[model samples]
Target: MTKPFDVKIGINPISWSNDDLPSLGGKTPLSVALAEGKAIGYQGFELGNKFPREPEALRAVLAGHGLELVSGWYSGRLARRSVEEEIEAVDTHLTLLAFNGAKVMVYGEVADSIQGTQEPLYKRPRFFHPEQWRDYADKLNAFAQHTLSRGVRVAYHHHMGAYVETPADVDRLMSLTSESVGLLFDSGHMTFAGGDAVAVLARHVGRVCHMHCKDVRPRVIRHARNRNWSFLESVINGAFTVPGDGSIDFRALIRLLYDNDYSGWLVVEAEQDPVVAPSYRYAEKGYRYLRDLVERVPLEAAREAA
Candidate 1:
């Protein structure tokens, strides 16, 4: 049975190789990653540090594997730098995305992020004072305009250690920026940040242009809190995983998106050590989990109609 709307499935290479901590899967070649990803039934892929930076070269590699370059991460330092500086930092990445015919660019503000570090994760990320919020939001609006001009959309990623990690942070950002700036809703991060993923989705579904289907282990999360683990430490302690293998109810989440007419890429973005949880196996598992969610109810409806 077909879904009522188009929702392509994609995966990130971080499942295979941690870009921040290269030691995780640094030895895993790009060729192997592309091959395994295609074999696991992913329709698209996000760019990783191992991927070729040149648009044409990257396109050729993806073309051979029958995959699309859906989107890639662009670190924006808008919290401290000028909008022009932010734009300049992302210009090359935006150009590559534009040239590759990708429509969305995931913008993660990394100026004060502790995502890659082993620092204590119990404290809240840096809070944006009112004046700083104004500046940051203004810059994001301008950056959205620039991306829109290039036939791409900027999807602000609310990540765990980044400044905009919590639900309130997301609300503040949405309120400050123009409607042109879209959101990249990640369910796992929301759960990790101690927020209701379903409610957050409901509140900001209109602004969401892309999605990341990540799941978390409650026990590891509890342990992380108890042990004062860092973001990377939590990941190392087995806090994250693909949809069904962990605690997130992806079915309920997808049903919400389905009912609300949500469409576009649903990316599997669980960053884990490849050795403990093999990449291809987890990729296949995540793919099946999402495939079931999208098809489960719709197929039953189709059968009843028949």
Candidate 2:
């Protein structure tokens, strides 16, 4: 069946192997991950810890499965470093992304981040001073321009424990940076951080370049907040899940993107224990949910035309 919408579905390798904790899917090979993702009808994949670093090698491996490189996460420190320094940190990755034909680079701020730390989630990083934001935005503008020079756009990822965790933080960052810097809209992280996923997308759809379609288990989220769990701890405790298995209303979200002419990679990214969730099963679940949504779009269009 053909899809009505023009979005390509991709999967993050974190489902097959947890990069932060390693032990979750440590034994699973990259080959296995690619095979399973392709088998489930994913046309692309995001880079993870076990992915090949060299462009040619990565390209050959992905081509073997008829998949493409969607994007890769680049940990940014523009909040505390010079523009030159932040660019240097992601130069190699940017080169690889360009060589492999990726358009968006996931820029996540990790300056003093408590993402993987055992500390409480309440201690997650945040930038407070106006002067600090001015300096960071200036650096981000230069860095985005540098990446644009190489034909790749920067999509800032608002991660759970990073500097841009809340909806207000996203608003501030969008306000500070120029339109060249796009937003990597992630539904799961926004919900996990207590932000309205739909509201954020509605407000920033024009500035969104890439998207992450992950859902959350509401009870687990409540548990995490009540127990003062860290970001990684909440992930370990089953706070996130594939779209159909969680509480988020993805039908509405997908329709919103479709109506707004949003087109690009819609990646399914849920960092879970591979043993508990079973990578292949969850990947297939997410793929089916998205495919079904796309199939129904034509009907919705017909209704609108009527």
Candidate 3:
């Protein structure tokens, strides 16, 4: 039987968090993601991990717009001192997101100690010191058990500067972890870290409960290479852009997910300045391209049956 292709749409609030671009959006970050999602044809949004901690209020706001929380990218780190502590933190944060309709909390940060003082964290990353992977997985398992107990799913986001920053690390961590844990595949970040986004997406498709629709510029990547720059630097230097405006092929990527029986949110996460282009221009473009990608990207499997 073919899988359903009811692709979910979302926006990242980081762009809207900018003090500039007061035009095409709202005052707060959650407001911006919800409003933009509504205006640009998105079905819902993954309330960014940094949203206000109050679940009741956030849910109220999302419900008012006829919107749903596709998922929440929980940006909590799991590599703290103890597994017990990590599980405790997840227990608290997971409940907050669940009350607001979110099913996942992305393991979203590097070992905080290693981050140093880079504003925006645009460095090459020295996360090779993941001395806690096995123990971390045990902690994550405990968290997942608690979250799933609360009727929520926990997805781990392997980032560039974070512990699991590369293909080998992602493989080591995911391979070791039990099926209780899910993964949030970020295309742009994977590519930035010299990892194959498509390969990782395909390999971990089953474990993916949610995905980020961010892409990167090959030109900027090459520039970074020439400068011997860091992954975070590439992100800061516009090495990343909206999907269609970048090098990654979403058509093929979406088709893969559609084939894998994947049915979850596809968040349009643009972590860049909206001022460089026309106000909301890149976002508007990304919105259109992703919507079209969802509706128009030939799901041969879906199409043949349709």
Candidate 4:
């Protein structure tokens, strides 16, 4: 039967080897991660630190594992840099993504971000003035428009310790930016940021071009919140986990995506200590859970229609 929504399954390599915390799964090879993820039936993968930067080499490596390049994260300093400088910085990474058939580039605003640091999560940066938001959006609009012209769209990622961490922040950013600046709706981050993923998706479904199906442990998040832990500290304490292993309702999330006719990659991204969670095991679990949900959604839709 044909599916209700057009979607592809992908996984971020952070589960195998984290980019921010090198020591977490740092010893794991890129090849092993790719092979195991491909074996779990992931159709694509997001770029990781260890992945070859050369487009041709990256292509060959993914081709070997029968996986497509689903796009990668771009640390955007558009909040502080001019549009010209931001565009110049993204050139090489953008080329790699476009060459590998990725339609969207995951853009995370890292300017003044405490995500990679030991600063408490409560210490996340914020835009205190209206002009700050406007200036940042103007720069982002120009940059996203430029990238869209080059074939790949920019999907803004609302991260934990960045300026755009809260639901209100996402709403504000979406209101300020043009349609060219698509939203990268990440469920885990949304939940961790005290927002309902379903509600957020419903509100910005039109602007959402990519998705990160990340799940979080509520108890860990509560502990982090109570103790005022850093983003990295929370991650180390197992704040994130694969779908079917955490609190987020994937069935409801997928059903909403199907209802909205969402057509893009649903990337499974959960940063966890590989030694504690076991990368391949959690990868397989997440893959099977999402695969089942995706398959079941269409059947449920047809039944309802009948």
- For model 4, name the residue pairs that clash: none
* Candidate 1 residue lDDT tens string, 38-141: 98889989999998999899999999999999899998888888878877888889999999988999998888788878877856466648987887888889
The TM-scores of all predictions, comma-separated, are 0.95, 0.97, 0.84, 0.98
lDDT by residue for model 3 over 172-198, one digit each (tens)? 878878788888888887887688888
Order of quality (lDDT): 4, 2, 1, 3
lDDT of 2 at 52: 90
| Clashes per model (N, Cα, C within 3 A) | 0, 0, 3, 0
1 or 3: which has the higher lDDT?
1
Q: Each candidate's lDDT (Cα)?
A: 0.88, 0.90, 0.69, 0.94
**lDDT tens string, model 2, 150-188?**
999999999988888889999998999998899999999
Q: Kindly list the per-residue Cα lDDT of model 4 for residues 1-96, writing each as its tens digit.
A: 445579999999998999899999999999999999988899999999999999999999999999999999999998888999999999999999
lDDT of 3 at 169: 73
Error of 3 at 300 (Å): 2.9
- What does candidate 3 score on TM? 0.84
Order of candidates by TM-score, top first? 4, 2, 1, 3
Candidate 2 Cα outliers beyond 4 Å, as residue runs: 1-4
